[model samples]
Target: MELLRSLAAALAVGVLIGIERGWRQREAADGSRVSGLRTFGLLGLAGGLASHMPESLAAVIGLAVTASLVLGYRSEQARTASLSITNTLVGIITFALGYMAGQGLVSETLAVAAVTTLILTLRQQSHAMLKGMSHKEVESIATVDYR
Candidate 1:
């Protein structure tokens, strides 16, 4: 019953982030290296489940999964141009924290998760503006003769 509740909380957190990503069309069509809201939420639940195991084992598994997600995103970004994995990872961690909150481990997990979500959500606009600036710079340079 507790596990179910934890899972539900995790899924809710995941879905919240997922809805945003899906609405923004942040995922790739090929689905190769992308980790959207659902993936992140599931990963968090899995991490929570793993936490039930021995502490050392849980820590190792969590770190391994987090590292893999990061590396996978880096590789995917190099191969194809799209949203970075940092925000996705943040979502995953947020979901995990939500699960922890559901399990009664921490009192402020929801607040922390909300803040993290906000940070991730805002990143899109900052990145887009940066890209736009780069584009403007390139265009301006193109118009100026080097010779």
Candidate 2:
């Protein structure tokens, strides 16, 4: 059925993203990371499942997931003394993509997932680029882009 296809798409997206996340976090000490392959996969599945429900139900589920991610972020920060919200944002995105896939927007979901995976996988390069950039240069670019 269509629902099965959606769920499959969601699962594939989760696993695809998870491969990158898991690879990045593989060296981290266990229990330090907020999420890895399994958690992301479940989040995607949850989103897909909720997508078939009423709009209010889906909204509530999304809000609840957001709150949970926020709490997880706080917990991670407390443990590590420093943490980025990138994982939390990815979680939200994964969920949304799953919902989109469930709604039969499979191509768009796959495209976004590919872009998200690329971003997540390029953390080191991204950080290096940011670190190498001067504040003035960043400001200039931002000002020009905004204008």
Candidate 3:
């Protein structure tokens, strides 16, 4: 039915992003990565399902999701001694896209999902670009002073 299709799209979105995350963290030991394929997949499904619930219930579910993501990130920071929020942000975005798809904005959801995955895939290139830049160059770029 229509709900099934929406949920399927949501799952697909999650899998798409999960592919990038899983591949990027393939070398990390189990439980080390902030989230892998299964976690993202569940998040996407949760988004779709939450979209179908009553507005109040949906809001509560969203809050729960956000809280869980924040807590997970804090736990990860403790274990890794790093403070990156990229994975958490990506997870939230994926959930949003799934919700959009559930709300019948399929094309827009897919488009943004593609862009999201592209950004996630570019992490190495982004880091390399910054690492290759001089401090002055970075400051100039940050300040929008092309001169």
Candidate 4:
């Protein structure tokens, strides 16, 4: 019924995110990336399910999921010396959106998810724009404190 609908919404949120994320990393060799569509989908599902638990339990579960994603990011960063935290942040956001869905906030969840996916989808264009910028152009916009 309602729960099923919520879960479906939650899963949809994950799929949306996963599509963008997977597309962003399409150049990476197979099995190279730590997460893809299925992983994101599962994370969303987990968040929705966690919402059904008692309040304290839900909080604990949320913390655990966040911690795990952070730790995984840290581990990958250390191993590869990569500085990006975008994937981890996306995972956390997806989970939150799923939790929102479970709480009967499907519209809000979808809106946020759409925004997040848009950001992910714009990666190449953003990088291209940055690369096209002159040094002075970048310096002029950068907010650095002289003092």
lDDT of each: 0.64, 0.87, 0.85, 0.90
- Estimate, for each residue in 40-135, the C-alpha lDDT of model 1 and write its tens digit: 666666655665668787678767777777777767777877675665466557546754755655436556666666766787697887677877
lDDT of 4 by residue, 16-51 (tens): 999878777788888777787888998888889888
Q: Residue pairs in steric clash, candidate 2?
A: none
Which 10 consecutive residues of model 1 have the lowest summed lDDT?
101-110
What's the residue-level lDDT of 8 in candidate 2? 93
Ranking by TM-score: 2, 3, 4, 1
- How much does candidate 1 score in TM-score? 0.65
- Clashing residue pairs in candidate 3 are none
Ranking by lDDT: 4, 2, 3, 1
In candidate 3, position 46 carries an lDDT of 85
Q: Compose the digit string of candidate 2's lDDT tens values, residues 1-147.
A: 988999999888888888788888899888765688888887788788889999999999999999998899888888888768888899899898889888988888889999999988888899999999999999898789543
Scored by TM-score, the top model is 2
Clashing pairs in 4: none
| Winner by lDDT | 4
Q: Output the better candidate (3/4) by lDDT.
A: 4
- Residues 82-123 of candidate 3 have per-residue lDDT tens digits of 888988888888888778878877778778889988988888
Q: Give the clash count for model 1.
A: 0
